[model samples]
Each structure stands twice: as C-alpha cells, then as structure tokens.
Target: MHQLSLLGTGLIGMFYTQSLHQYQPGVRVAHVYSRRKERAEKFAADWDIPRWSTDLDAAINDPHTDTVLIGLPNHLHKTAILKAAAAGKAILCTKPLAMNAAEALEVLEAVEAAGVFHGYLEDLCYTPKTLKALQAVQNGALGQVLWTRSREAHPGPHSDWFWDPTRSGGGAIIDMGCHCIEIGRNFIGKQVQPLEVVCWADTLVKPIDAEDNAVGLIRYESGALSQFDVSWTYRGGMDLRDEVAGENGTIRLDHWLRTGFELFTETGMGGYVAEKAESETGWLFPVGDEVNALGYVHMFRDMFEAMDAGTAPMETFYDGYVVNAIMDACYRS
Candidate 1:
C-alpha cells in the first residue's frame, strides 16, 4: 500500500487526499500537515487521517508514509521536495515545481540524484477531455499535431501568496500559464524539443507586480507551433479550453464552461456551483463530480499505479522543469 504524507491543508491538498481515498486502491494519506495547528488537526480529522502536525519536517519524515505529496504554496515547493527527497520518499509535487527554471532545475536534480519516483501533479493535462484528445492524436485521428492552443482563465487564485510575486514567482503566466504551456506541450509532443518562444504579458486588471494576463507562442523542433493564452481577469467563470490541429484533422475541447451538464437556477445552486463560479443563481455549469472532472481521480490512479509498477507516470519533474523553462522564456520575451 502507498501510504502518503500530504503536506498541505489547502484546497489542492484536499483534492489530492480525496482522490487518493476514493479513487485509488492501496493508497491513503497516512499523515496530514499544515502551517496552522488547528487546520492540520482539522484536516486530519476530516479526512480520517491517522496523524497531523504543524511541523514540516515531522510530517515529511513520518515513518508510516512511503510517499510525500507536496501541495504547499509555490514558494515552499522546493524545500518540501528537498526534504522528502532526503527522506528517500517517493515525491509527487504540484506545479510549477519551483519559482523559476533555475529553481525547477535544482528540484529536478535533487529528485534525480535521490533516485526517487517523482510525478508532476499537473491535473489539467490529465483531464478526461485531455486524455481523450491525446488518444485521438496518438491514434493518428489528428495527423501530425502541427499547431495547438490552450487557454485557462479565471478570477484568480484563492490564497494571498498568489498575489505576491515573490511568493508565487509570477502572476497569471506562472499560475495558469503553467497549465496552458504544459497542455500545449502535450499536443506538440514532449520529446520534440521547443525551439523558440515569443510572448506578451501585462498586468491589465489586477494591481500586482506580476502580470495578470499573458499570451505566448512556442515553436517546436518539428516545426509545430503551440500557443497559450492565460489570464486571471476573466470574470464569468473558469474557462478551460484547448484546440489541436494536424495535417489530417482537428480536435476541439471545452472542459469547464460548456460541459453538457448545465443548469439555470433562479435561486442559488444550493451551495458550490463549480470551482471558479462567481454566481450561484444563474446559468451555471455545476460539475457533476469536481474531483473526477478536474482529472484528480485519473491523476492519482496513474500516480499510484506507476509507483507500484516501478514506472514513470505521464508527468515527471523533468516535464515540469521544461515547462518552467518555457515560462521563463515567455516572461523574458
């Protein structure tokens, strides 16, 4: 059994724990950790976890835990990952791995040197819609994936750290662009090296040091061009969409906004409508199952299965590093 030590009590951490418990077999979050004692204790209790701690090291070094899932803020990713690596624990970390390509390189090297199983927790790349699109590409339904685009926009991140550039590393480009860049990489192919990048970004809406809006283009060695558009100023709700084109055919996906299961409610939709929904009493796209729809279930399942079989999951720290490097180039451009 893969007993995991989850090192965050935030929304991401909850999704990770929930996915492991309900979706994956032979996997459980053995320990929960939070910066706050009460949150740590409450998270543990809510999830029926055996242990909780306010201490980062104590939580990571939990002997009962064989795997460490780092769901902490962007700034703390490197430290927690380094700690987990030192403990010889299998590590799974959320993106963008570190503050920049340099930090991401350090993280990548540490995990490689430790020779531990590492998976990059890029859930957007594993969504059901994305998986199906990738399959169609692999099956040659879409010929050569020459051009691709992915766009992710929402109000903004939930936590305060995101608003701080020093902590978050960047603004919308780093926050949501990580997802879009990686999604483009998926369609363009990972093995094919990215040759060039050109981008434009500005803090058009939010008053922050980091840019709240960005658009980037990457050219692959195979002459494929992938473009990404990311923003935190989008008002209506979260918009997750992607398009892929090839010599043979094309594929279009609408992940969140236009999901078939839609409802119009006069009164608030009881409670939560979806991840980034602004209104409860309107035409809403209430996700049937947020965890499953967001690809947490697929992601965790693939992670544990790969861990068990001693194989690499679809996403690794190296992939994260590549995406960070591309983001760095985009930011510089």
Candidate 2:
C-alpha cells in the first residue's frame, strides 16, 4: 500500500482525503497538515489520519509517507513540491502547478533533480465525458479537427485564499482555466504553445485585485484556435464544456454534467450517444468509467499505476506548465 501525506486542510484537501479513504483502498493518507496546528489536528481527527503536523517538513519526512499530495494554494504548489522532493517523496500536485510557468518549471526541475515520480492533478481531463469525446475524435468520427473550445468556471470559490492573487494565482483563469487549457492539449495530443493570446479580465467581487471574470483566445501549435470564458461571476451556474469541430462532424462534451457526446455531421447526419466513457473499456481513471471520481483518488490511482510502469500520467508538470504559460501570456496580453 502507498502511504500518502496531504498538505493544506482546505476544502480541496478535505475532499481529496475523503476520496482517498473511500475510493483508493490501496493508498492511505498517513499524515495531514495545515499551517495552523489546531486546524491540522482537527483535520486529522475528522479524517482519522494517524498524525497531524503544522511543520511541512515533518509531514514530508514522516517515515510512513511515500507520497505527498500538495493541495495548497497555487503559489504554494512550488514550495510544497520542492520540499517534498527534497524529502525524496513522490508528489501529486494540485492543478495550475504554480502561479506561472517559470515557477512550474522550477517544480519540474526539482522533481527531476530528485529523481522522483510526480504528476499534475488536472481533473477535467479525467472527467468521464472528456475521455469519451477524445475517443470519438480519434476514431475519425469527428473528422479532421478544425478548432476546440473549453470553458470551466463557477461562482467564486469558497476559500479566502482563492480571492488573493498571491495565493490562488490570478483568479478565475488560474482557478479554472487551467482545466480547460490542459483538456484541450490532451484532446489534441500535442503541445499548445500559444502563438498569441488576447485576454480581458475583471474583478466584481469584494475588493480583491484578482479577476473574477475572464475571456481569452489562444492559438495552439496544432493550428487550432481555442476560445475560453472563465469566471467567478456567472449567474447561470457552474459549467464545463468543450466543443471540438472537424471537417465532417463536431463533438461536444459537458464534463460536469456527465452527458454523453453530441455529434453533428456536415450532411445533417447527427446523433447522441450515451456512454460512461470508461464502462466499455478497461481504461483506468482519466480514461474510463466515471467510478464517481470526485476528489483526487482517481488521479492518484492513475499516477501510481503509471509510476510502477515508469511512465508519466496523462497530466504532468509539463501539461501544467503549458496551461500556466498560456494563462500568464493571456494576463500580460
């Protein structure tokens, strides 16, 4: 069994622990940590973890902990990953990797230098609907690709750290855009080195300097022009959708809704197919049946299997780097 340590007692951290306990029977969250000692203790009590530590190093150095899951805020991603690497523990870092590409690269370098396995936890690509869409596209059902668009956003996150630019990265784009951007890359099976990205962002909630809404256009190396609308101020409720167009047909995936694919062909031949995305195949998480993969359990499971085989999971530090780099460029643009 793989022993895991989790940093940060925030919502994501709590959800990850719950999922690990519920879905990943092969893994155990041996230690739980928070900057606040009391909170760490409480979290441990709630999760029934064996130990709690306010000192990040202690958790990293814990003898039973072979894997470290960094669920901290975006900026802390680099620091925690680096500390875990220094302790020789494999790492599973939360999405966005870091506030920007440069920091993401630093984390990648640290993991490589330590010769430890590491993966970026970008959940959207693992969502059931997305895997289905990717298969449809690959099977020529979607024809030659024309463009792809993905959007992931929700009314502002409940965490205070989410509103802080220094802590959460840059609001909705980093909070949510990373998912869409990475999903796009996974769908196309190529790098999305944005030739240019134009962005417009706004802040309407509270007094934070971070943006609550953003719209961006990205040109990928595959000659695909992607558009995204991410926001913390949507009144229509949370949504995550990706539409891929091809010469013969177009495929649409609604990730959060778990709806199956909608294919529209040029000759007006269109249909809807219901699939669990993974039910028909022995595909693992991020590739097969939903299996109620809520928190990071599926992600960890995928990573562990990949590690044993000496291969990287679907989403890696490089994937996170590409998303953040695009986000940074959009912010600058």
Give lDDT per model, in order. 0.92, 0.76
TM-score of each: 0.98, 0.86
Model 2: residue 297 alpha-carbon error in angstroms:
4.6
**For candidate 1, lDDT tens digit of each residue in 82-135?**
999999999999988899999999989999999999999999999998999998
| lDDT tens digits by residue: candidate 2, 95-144 | 87998989988888889899998898886677555766788877889676
Model 1 stretches astray by more than 4 angstroms: none
lDDT of 2 at 327: 92
Q: What C-alpha RMSD separates each model from the true structure?
A: 0.9, 8.6
Model 1 local distance difference test score: 0.92
Error of 2 at 197 (Å): 1.3
